[model samples]
Target chain A: MKHNFGAGPCILPQEVFKQASHGVLNFNNTGLSILEISHRAPEFVAVMDEAISLVKELLNVPEGYSVLFLQGGASLQFAMTAYNLLPEDKKAVFLETGVWAKKAFAEANLIGNAEVIASSKDKNYSYIPKDYTVNADSAYFHCTSNNTIYGTQMHSFPQTPVGKVCDMSSDIFSRVINVADFDLIYAGAQKNIGPAGATVVIVKDEILGKSGRKIPSMLDYQKQIDAVSMYNTPPVFSVYTAMLNLRWLKAKGGVAEIEKENNEKAKALYAEIDRNPLFKGTAAVEDRSKMSVCFVMENPDLEKPFLKFAEEKGCVGIKGHRSVGGFRASLYNALPITSVHALVEAMQEFAEKNV
Target chain B: MKHNFGAGPCILPQEVFKQASHGVLNFNNTGLSILEISHRAPEFVAVMDEAISLVKELLNVPEGYSVLFLQGGASLQFAMTAYNLLPEDKKAVFLETGVWAKKAFAEANLIGNAEVIASSKDKNYSYIPKDYTVNADSAYFHCTSNNTIYGTQMHSFPQTPVGKVCDMSSDIFSRVINVADFDLIYAGAQKNIGPAGATVVIVKDEILGKSGRKIPSMLDYQKQIDAVSMYNTPPVFSVYTAMLNLRWLKAKGGVAEIEKENNEKAKALYAEIDRNPLFKGTAAVEDRSKMSVCFVMENPDLEKPFLKFAEEKGCVGIKGHRSVGGFRASLYNALPITSVHALVEAMQEFAEKNV
Candidate 1:
């Protein structure tokens, strides 16, 4: 079996793939491919409903929030969060951690007054900024919960009086979080949810429709909620397969259980990075992502060799982002502990060879 | 044996379904699911490239135009087209044909000065409005190439002085069109492309980046082209499956061949609708859609029975849109003429019983 560690649009449970594959052929034995099923049809509607429900059940989503399945990925969410929540007069505050967080701020800045209160850019986003205070008069406090590129994650969110909006695109649903902690949480479904096309937004009902800007209906959170995510035809197969993935997540005892498993996987790989003589962890130890484990070889020259060495051992997609050149093994919810073990063994073997 | 006539997120070739299903489990023998592959991966990049190439090849899109596969169905395009193309000062005129046309106008109107220059709404949008001259000074002239709800297709586009934009969501690949005639053509891929998640836009490069509004990156067509539809992660499975569907279209001798089959399918059904004493065509006779064929029983009371009768004969998704109140058998490119024959046979058998 190939160990897929390619970051977001990464691995899901094997069963989800099998189940989703079956759906593309014959969804629920309707004798119609999920690819062909009408979004308005009862069967597909049920899939959308259940997918939303699974999100609620899995996350213990609070009642005051609206859950949405939308398109255009987290990049669109960056613009939408600003359009739907940031007001004309008030400035939006951001703790810029990485590229995604910066993009989130940039979009908001384009629409209205938005400023970065804290940034880790000087250190190449190796650590999450911890000492930023969101202005009480701000429109919202925006942050990226996990930085997929740098492998840094906000272990705890900054407490803010203003609305809290977080782009949890890389690490959502990998662990449990209190749903009431943030006013808005948007995640690209490519990571932990299901696939690339659908993005999930959990927005507190009260925070939307407050932006004075005339938002497009597609970008308006309130409109999407009112239509119950059917404002337009949702990404059908993406949502359907996402439902199957969520169902699998639910069956695996939801976020808490998955979180525990995730902890073990991250722990195993990070331990090897620390213990192995040839490798070193890249992110700030405290802020290192549980989902995307980033690391580098002690000698830069050995990086390519290790990557090739690891791939030969079936530990693929371990090549790190060019910005942080070495390796990144994304231990998403579906990536098994066995894959982690395999990666750890590769690291150990590579270290011995290099020595 | 199932005849899927459901409107978009509608039917695709059965072989496309099988290939897509196989890709889901193990894409290209890469030991990675298509659902899991990174959009940045060379494998998926090739899929995206081939998809764009196939669109150009099939449609004979000119060199100056960029073909983009994007997310957020046509509804998003309703907003995006206006946001991208309509300038702050000039009015965008429209020939409103159906509900979709009205929506396209509404979204454009929200962004700037957009008005309906002509409309077929007075006749319940049963015909395409023919006698309208677009102002040379207008920002753009927009039209819906095919009105899915009312079962009307534009047999000939209006010769316009301004930039011509068309939403060909229902009838894009079903007919041959001179691509050079329109400045931009956008279609939600659900109908004739592949699935619900992706929307296709063939846009002239010169027309974009002139709106003078600070368009959001996701909504900005120029930004999308600069990034080549990889501005963000596109719907991976949708684009891949669309590529497969397009490959199938090319294999079946491309759009020219499909249009002939589409014509024959429409002819057989419309003829039966006219000949059967219990039924009547809903759209204006000359403006009938080759893709979506809507018809009603002469006795409204017999509608329910006829629907059941057709479904029993495996002519599923034939129920008409609520606005039309009859039956709509969408004969998309992938829908075989055999399925159309089966639907016609069911209609004939039902007519015999009613008599």
Candidate 2:
């Protein structure tokens, strides 16, 4: 009955969890934990192949794109993309929307020069910036698709003159998008996909080998592609769970159908925040994330009691991030509409009791 | 009845896998996929704390040593260790034993000046080199504790005038060792531990912050130690499985007991290979790895049928590395004596048939 709103590593379908749990005991009836199997073994290779293939199909990736399941999460990709793509003395453009974008920029700056094309940081990143021009000569333009902490999202993606890479860690597979527009897209699996160990990276095959730098094998996309994501030992259990989750998504009519349900869930919760006198939404209306809804109380002292009341009513993980205090109800792909409805009801009860 | 002898992502104790399976579905009865829990949440933080604490106890790690569970496997550590510890002006000493050692040297050479003080490659790395001298002012000395491809091991660790680091990727936790001998040690979890995504790094705190070179946050040992491995989203499921495996290791008596079993298994298998006229052990007796036993036929043409025959007799993953063709039997902590007996019997039958 409890609603999970904790962001990234947040929530997953019950059926996906069940199937993944069984994989740890016996994967493909091999009588071995998926963790115990070799990544190169035909049995595990089949699992890896299907996971990558399904992601391409589910996301409707273009023909030239190759999907890679890598370790080190999105944080590592921030450095890897910059190291592998940025030309020796040139730069890359970045849109600093929130924590993730800032991190990407920071890494790019450390490895090579990078310009901040636009930034919403001046206003505490409550909205995504607009009307920024990407330099055609730059290596690639990078931006975060969804900000987990501030509950802000890029409602419309930027048109990059250069190649485009999106850190879709929080909102991947939640909606259908033109995969061909992006040169590279990377997402940590904990949020909308499956688990913490794996990060899904889809890259256009032709976009590689441009940077003259001798990129380390682990960070090099070409090396990863050549080895079939088996250049080294992979996060086997995490990858298997991701496959299970993708299967669940396919069963539920893929991303297009899931997007509708997600939109409705966000609307129900956002409507309650708007209607209630005691709470106020945090992010800009147009830029607010459908995945994570951040809101603060009109009466600051009521925050603790409101959280307590919500917890008592079986709504959990509603406390906002410490940096931006209030409440954040993360409505991810797996969060049921019933959970969003329950949160709305709790908000109504709290407003009635307080005001 | 099947024996799994794959080098890594290898066998794990059945009990560990069983317990880990349950946690994936409902971690600690919290109705959350272990994959879905935030690394900073109390539930997962507790898991991380326990895993680190258990590793400390089981390894008898000193107070000054900090244990960190990281991503990118041992491959990433090759570059990270050099970047973090190797000073700009001085060369780090490396002992080239096999494929992994060569990889470490290549990465180090790319980052800074590196010296290969000794090499076994002249003999195709069939033996570990001896009578090598360590530089007095070298940044650090690096060696692979066990060679996965050639099945050779450093029977006794090197005594260096400077700090020492060992890439114990394939042989860590198989036996007790003097922790004081090395300033840092790293191992991929897939082999002797639980799974692949997590890498265990134990560092002596005093040896850090010396390099003055700017290390990316992910590669900095101090940054990870400061955050207690929560600097970024961790491989939660993998670490949890490692904890389960560690718990199993403790329940059956720690590394000391596991070492005894490992030794016995290796001895039985090697005896069969040595006594059989048709087969020949690959590595020199003095340098042979207790974990991985590499062998091939006196005549190379019999390799294919020998592998097929072994596989048919319920022995899996016994194929040798392409670099060194023949067969490899990886006897890790979780690999029981019975499996080794099964492999030994299969080898005996194959030898009789070939003769």
Candidate 3:
């Protein structure tokens, strides 16, 4: 079997994939394909309900928080969240860590006003910015929990003066976090969750409907919440696959147990990068993401050779972001620790042969 | 065998469903599920490419038109189309035929200036409004070709002074239409296409990039076309299923052959509605939709019993839209004429027993 570590649209548990595939063929043995079933049907509605409730239970979400399965991914939410939350007079505070954070900031700025409280751009986003002051007049503080590109993650979420919004696109359900700490959270459900079709949004009910803009009905948070995420025939197949994946996550002891295994996998790869003579970890020591372990060849000349060696050993998707141009071993919740071991051994063997 | 006549999120061919289900489990025998594959990967890129090509081939899309598979359904396109085409100085001309047209006009009004040249709302949208003039300064003329709620359709598309945009959400692929006649066309895929997650947008390249508005990247037609609809991770499963359905459409002799069948199905049902003394059609004779055939019990008291009778006879989803409070039989391309015969038989049997 080949090992998969691609970032976002990445690997999923085999059981989840199998069950999802089975549903596609004959959901509940109704003799009707999931692709053909109406979303308004009681069967699919139950799927949506269970998916929402599972997300709440797994995250230990507060009573007032509502989870939504929406389209347009986290990139759209970069503006949609602002459209629903930020008024014309207020600015949003953003912590700029990498490419995704900058994109988020840009989209928010396009909609209205946004301020980058702090940025690590001086170092190509190798570290997380700290000690940034949240503006009192800000509508929300938006941050990316894990930088899929730079391999950095915020270990401690920043508290904002007015409200907090986090883009957990690459790291939701990978670890445990207090859902009560943030007013809103959105994640593109391709990494650490299910597929790429649906984006999951969890928000505190009290924080919505504050913006003065005439929000488009599809982008309006209040409209989605009122409709129970059934607003306009939600991405049914995507939501159903997400439900299956969430069920799989719950069966494996939820996020807490998944987090422990994730940490061990990250630790294994980072240790190899440290001990191997030809390899080096990329991100700042403490800020490195447990979900995405990035590293590079010390000589740069060995990059191609190491990649070739790893690929020959059935290790797939170890290529790093094009901007980074090294290697990123995304240790998402579904990736087996054995795959990390295989990569580590391959790296050591390549070093022994070349260096 | 149950007969599915749901308005949308409706039925698809059994062959397409089976093939889609198989792909979900093992896409191309790569041992990786379609949900797990990256959109940029050759496997899924081929999927997107084939899907676009099939749509083009089926519609006989001209060289200047580009087909894009986008998210956020046609409702988002209600604003997005206006955002991209309607300028501050010019108003969009809309021909209001039914609920969908009015909703489209309202959304365009929210974005910029949009005026309804004519409307059939005075008669509960029983017929299409002709003799509407497209203003000289109009940015574009918009219309809903098939009114899903009212069960009416445009027998002939209105010629406009400026550009033309149509939301053909319910009846897109069921019949053939000249692609060169319209500047832009969009449809939510839940109806005649595939599932609910994706929307198909076919736009004339020359018409875009003219609107003077800061369009959100997700909503910008030019940006989506430039990126070849991979601007973001698309609804992979939705696109995949649509591709399967489109493939089935082409193999079964494309839209031309399907239209003949659709017309026959509509004819059979409408003939029954006309012949039966207990039933009456809601839409005007010339404007009645071939895709959605709506009828009501003439006695009014027979509605409940007829519905129960039909349900007991394996007829599902015959309930009409709540707004109309009657029975609607949606004869999508995937639905066989035999199902329509079954529906007609059920109606005749019910009328005999009740009379």
Candidate 4:
């Protein structure tokens, strides 16, 4: 079997894929493909409802927060967070983490005044910036919880005076966090949730309607939540498959259990990276992400050769992003520990060849 | 055995569903689910490219026009159209024919000066408003090509003094149209295109980059086109399935052929509605949608029984919209003429009982 280690829109449990594939043919045996069913139909509506409810249950979302399944990935969320939460006169504060973080800040600044209080870009974002303080006057404190490119993750969020907004796109369900800790947590469903279409947003009800801008109905969080996340015909199959995937997650004992698996997967891969003579981890040891385990061969010229070696062993998508220039094995929740073991073995076999 | 007449996220070719289902489990036999592949991966990039190329070919989209597969459906396009086209000072005019038209004009007005140059709301949208002059000073004139709620359509578009924009949400790809006639033509894929998660936007390149407002990247057509519609991670399966559906359309001899079939389906059903003594057509005869055929019973109390009757005979989703208070049988492209014949037979049977 091919071990898929591609970043976001990566691996999902095979059972979920089977169910989703079956759904595309005959959903709920209604003799209708999920792709063709009306969102208003009771069958699909129940799927949407379950998708939303599962997010709340899986995260233990508190009473005052609302969970939304929306279109437009984290890219759109970058601007939407500013439009709904940042007023014309307000300054939105940000932690500059990686390319996504930079883009998030740039988009927010395009709509309103956005300031970066701290950055790890000086060292190619190998670690999280921890020294600077968020301004109390800022509209909101925005941060990217995980940098997929550099494989850095903020293990703990900073407490801020204003609202806290985090883009948890790459690492959302891999670990558990207190829902009430942040004012908003948005994740593109691709990585840990389900697929690439639906984006999951959990927001505190009270933080909305404060932007004072006449936001479009599609971009306004309050209106979307008011419509009960059926704001527009949501990504139907995405939501349905997401529900199926979440059901799988629930059956596998939710985030805590998945987090344990994710840790072991990352530990096994990183341990090999550290122990192997030809390789080394890329990110700062403390801030390295559990979701995306990025590393490089010590001998730069050997990188391409090792990539081919890994591919021959059916270790797919092990090549690193161009920006990072090494390797990124995304240990997402759905990737089995066996895949990590396989990657580790390949690395060991390759190291023996080189040494 | 089932005839689906649901307005949107409606019927698509059964073979397309089969292919789409296969793609989900083992996309191109890559041993990976379609949901797990990276949008940037070569295999998926090919899928995205083919999806765009198919739109251009099927629509005969000339040079200087960009075809985009975007998320957020037509609702977001309502605002995006104005955001990218309507200047702060210039007015955007609209022909308000139905609820969708009214919402489109309303959304445009929210961003800039907008006016409804004509409206059919006075008659409960029973007809398309034909008499109105679009101001030469208006930035662009917008119209809904098909009204799903009221079952009204603009068979022939108005020649506007300025740029012409159309929301062809419900009836795109059912018939052929000159892409040069409109500056922008957008449709939610659910009805006739593919599925709910993706929207198709065909825009003339010359009409862009003049709005003067700093539109956000996701809503800005120029930016999206520049990015080749990969502005964000697209709705993967929706676009993939859309490609398959479009391929089906092409193999069935393209839009001209489908238009003939669509015309025949509308003709057969409308003839039955007019001939049946117990029922009558809802929209004006000249303006009745060839896609959504709406009719009401002569005796209103029998509506529920007729719906029940239709469903019992394996005719599904024939229930009309709440506001219309009648039956709306949407004859989207994927719906076979045989299904129409089946529905007509049911209507005839129901009329005999009522009489």
Candidate 5:
């Protein structure tokens, strides 16, 4: 009866959860918990191998791309991407759209010279910047595909003269994109994929080993690619859960079919928010995130009652972020239409009662 | 019936796995997968808070110490610890015991000036270096509590004139230790705790803020400690499983009782290895790791058949690392006495036939 709409570490398919739970107990009928298995074992290696292959298959990634399941989440990638890609005297360009982008900028600044090509920070990051010029000889153009807290998304990708890398932590696999356009894409699996602890990095093989800096073995993308993501002990349980989630994604007719469902769900919720007088949407209409619908009520006092009512009606995690107080309904890929409908009904009832 | 002795991303308790699996499906009866919940949510905050509290209580950690559940395994800590604790001007003293300690030393060398106080590398790291001089004004003295690959342990901790830090990745909570002795302690949860993806960091509050170097938020132990390990999205499932494992440890009379059991298991396995003429123990008698027992046959060519026979007899993951070839029986906390008995029986049979 309950719906989960919390942002990243957001909703995952029920079947994925069920299968993942089963694996923890008896992984491939090994009588050992998935935690107990060796990453080097043929069984676990197969799991990593298939997980990477499926990621490539689902995204239509080209042959040269190598997928790595790393520890430390996408936040680590903020440092790693810059550390591996940014050359000694050159700088990287970053488009700051939201909290994640800002974090990436800070990490890049720490390691090497980074220029903010454009930023929506002046407007509290309510919209993604448009038509920013990327340096032709720069290391890469970094962007965040979706902003979870700000409820903003890049409607279209930036035209990068150099290699393009994205922190798709929040919006990976929600829709199809031209995989060829990106040289690197990293996502923390807590959002649309599986659990925390694993971050997926799909990097073009050729773009690696160009960084003159002596990268640590763990931080080196090329080292990880050569070992096939088993350079160090990988997050085995998380990877397995991701595989199950990917299986669920594939079963529901892949990204194209899921995109339709996602669009429909977002449309239903956004329609309710736009029509409702008591509530006001937070992000710019042109750049609003389909995955996360952020809004606030007219009366600040009504926020508590609205959230309480929503919770009582089995609509959970509707409260917005503290920085931008309101309500955010995260309609991730696994969030069913029924849940979105339930949220819409709650919003309507709240609007009528308050008005 | 399969035994998992793979060093890290290692074995976990069956009951812990059961409870964790259930939590992933319906965390705290909220009808949401643990993956779906917000990290800032009161429910998850409570989970992390309790996990930290349990760590303190179980280890009898002092009041000044803060516990953090971070991503990036113990490997990351090598760089982070050096970056956080060491100033650019002063050298950090390192005690190189095995492959892990060597890695730690290498990472420290990359970041700042580090002095190798003593190293067992000359002796192939068979034993711990003893009677080493401590650098008085060094940033901190670093050592590995248990060497996973070489199967060696620092039975008695070194007396450091400077602050002490230990990478307790392999043998954390295996025995009672004076937590106050070290300024910091870090362990990758894969081995003894629950699963991969989460690393446990215990740091004294007073020892921080010394390094003038600007550390990236993720690498800064102080930032993690300040946010109470919520600086970034933590490895939720791993932390929850660790909580379950800690509860299991508590129910079984805490570390004291577990240590006794561990010692007995190690004794049984080591005795068999010593008595068997066909097999030779890899580590020194006094420095042997209670967690991992490395051994090799008189005829190294017999390794394949020995491993096959062991696998057939339900002794799995016994093959040693390629760097240090042979067999290793990783007797982690969750490894049952029955499993060790089974391994010993297999080894005896192999010795009888092969010799």
Candidate 6:
């Protein structure tokens, strides 16, 4: 058994993978390849509808919110959210926690007025920014809930008077959050949902159409919501695979149980990083990510050897983001505690040998 | 052994489906699911490179052109093309053949100046508009090669001095076209290529960057081309499946051989439709699409019973689009001639029973 620790598109339940494979070959015993079936067919429609409804049910989304499964990933959403929400006169507020947050801010700037309310760039984004003030007149207060590169997560949400928009790309569904806390939440499904093709958007219905600019039909949130995410032929196979993942998520006791197990895995790994003399955690202790556990070797010389050692121990995708070097052990919801234990054991062995 | 005639997200080669399904379960014997692998992984990178190369080879894309696999389907491309190509002062010309064409024109109108130079809407889009002037000052002359809903197609080309753009979503690889004739070509990979999650774009490198507006980063052609379609995590599974289909296409004697087969399939079905006393072809004779062949019953009362009988006889997804309110038999590239013969037999038996 190999341990997968890469950030997004990292790990998923084997059951989900199996079911999705079955779907691709013979969807519902229809003898028609799922890849060949129409997206508007009753079966595909059911898949789309069930996927959307399960998202709502899993999140316990409030009634006023609309859930959308869209293409172009969260990167498309970075521009779409700003284009649809930011008006000409009103500026958007952003909290820059890491690389993705900075990119999100830049995308918003491209569309219209956007201001970085706070940033942790000075300290290399090792922690979430805590002192940002949200402008009452701003279109929305945008923030990245989890920094995938730096391995820091926002444990406390900022109390914003204006609309709150969160890019929960890496940490969505790993933990439960109050659905009413944010005006909008977007996540790239490759992380915690299913695959790379689908993006999930949870938007409060009232927050849209205020922007005066004519939105591209595909980028319009209201248009997608009105059509119930079938505004066009949706990414069918991706959505179907995502539905299988969602079914798996629900079967495993939903987000609350998964969140508990997630903490256990993270705690075991972080405990090892803290105790081992040869390694150190990268993120600030208080803001360490429960999802992606970033760390580095205390003796820089041992880095390559430790990585090779880990690879020999059946650990895969443990390398950190190129922007931030060393190692990153992403403990997503589907990554079992046994994998974390295995990684921890490898780390301990490496430290004992090196130090 | 089912006959699939749905317009899009339609038939794909059975071999492609099998290989893709296997990849989903165990990609390249890595012991990790394809859905869980990183987009930047060497395996996935190979998948991307091979897919791009195959698309280039299949289309005979010139050296100066870039082939991009993008998300958001053709609907997004409708806006992206105009946003990238249409300058602020110069108008774009469009041939409005059907519903999709009208929508494409409207998307361009939202971005900049767009003129519908010709339209077949006067005749319920039963025929392709032939008489159209491509103004010399226009930025580009846009056309849809095949009208999926209205069952019409352009049998002749308008040789414009300006840039030429075509959305070949429904009938791209069914026939051979001179790649040099168009500045850009785009197709949603559902019908003729692969599944519904990916779109293929072939753009001449010289036609971009003329528009003054700051194109949305995701929609910017230059950025996408520069990044080699890896600017973000693409729809990995979709693109991989599409690559498998492309390989299948190449293995089946490429576009030239497929075109002959497609014509034969279309001819057989159209002949049956024309000869049946209960049926009548919907599209004009010269403009009928070889990919999507639509027909209606001469006796309207027989429509429901005929459809029911066809469905019972191992025919699946043959329903007509709601807008056209008639049976549509889409014979895309991967649709076997046997399926066409089955459909023809169904129509003949139904005609004998009813008439």
- Write one digit per residue (lDDT tens) for candidate 3, span B286-305: 99999988889888888988
Clashing pairs in 1: none
TM-scores for every predicted model: 0.99, 0.97, 0.97, 0.99, 0.95, 0.99
Mind sharing the TM-score for model 4? Answer: 0.99
Error of 2 at A130 (Å): 1.7
* TM accuracy, model 5: 0.95
- List model 5 lDDT by residue over B1-355, tens digit each: 7777777777778788888989888888977777778888889999899889889998999888899999888888888988899898999989998888988989888888898889999878889999788868788899999988888999999777888999999999999999999999999888877788889999999989998876777888888888999888888888888989999999899999999999999999999989988789999999999998999988888888989999999888888987678998899898899999998999889888976
Which candidate gets the maximum DockQ versus the true structure?
A: 1
Cα lDDT tens digits, model 6, A1-355, are 8888878687988888888888888999988777877777788899999999999999999999999999998889999998899999999988988888988999999999999989999999998878767878898999999888899999979778887899999999999998799999999999889988899999999888889988999999999999989889899988998888898999999999999999999999999999888889999999999998899988778889999999999888899887778999999988999999889999988877865
Model 6: per-residue lDDT, tens digit, B1-355? Answer: 7887878788888888888889988999998888889999899999999999998898888889999999988899999999899989999999999888888999999989999999988888999888778989999999999998878888768889898999999988888888889999998989888888899999999888888889888999999999899889999999999889899999999999999999899999999988887889888999998888888887777788888999988776677777777788888888899999898999888877776
Candidate 3's docking class is medium
* Best-first order by DockQ: 1, 4, 6, 2, 3, 5
User: Ten residues in a row with the worst lDDT in model 5 chain B?
Assistant: B1-10
Model 4 agreement with the true structure over A233-328: per-residue lDDT tens digits: 889999998999999999999999999999899889888989998999999999989999999988999999999999988889878899889999
Instruction: List per-prediction Cα lDDT, in the order shown.
Output: 0.90, 0.89, 0.89, 0.92, 0.88, 0.89
lDDT of candidate 1 over A87-137, digit per residue (tens)? 788898989888888888888888788999999999999998887677688
lDDT of 2 by residue, B1-355 (tens): 7788988898898888888888988889987778777788899999999999988988999889999999989999999998899889888999999999999988988888898999988899999998799979899999999998999998998667998999998988999987878999999999987788999999999999988776777788998999999889999988998998999999889999999998899889889888988888999999999998999999889989989998899898899999888999899999889999888888888877777
Clashing pairs in 5: none
Q: Candidate 1 vs candidate 3: which has greater lDDT?
A: 1
CA error at residue B170 for candidate 3, angstroms = 0.7
* Tens-place lDDT digits, model 3, residues A185-223: 999989976888799999999888888997888899898
For candidate 1, write residues B1-355 as lDDT tens digits.
8988888788888899999999999999998899888888899899999999999999999889999999998899989998888889899999999998998999999889999999988989999888878888999999999888899999998788898999999999888999999999999999989988999999999988888898888999988998989998889999999999999999999999999999999999999999889999999998998988888888999999988988999988888899988998899998888898998899888877878
- Worst lDDT window (10 residues) for model 2 chain A? A30-39
Looking at candidate 6 chain B, the ten consecutive residues that score lowest on lDDT are: B314-323
- Per-prediction interface RMSD? 0.9, 1.2, 1.2, 0.8, 1.5, 0.9
Model 1 lDDT at residue B236: 94
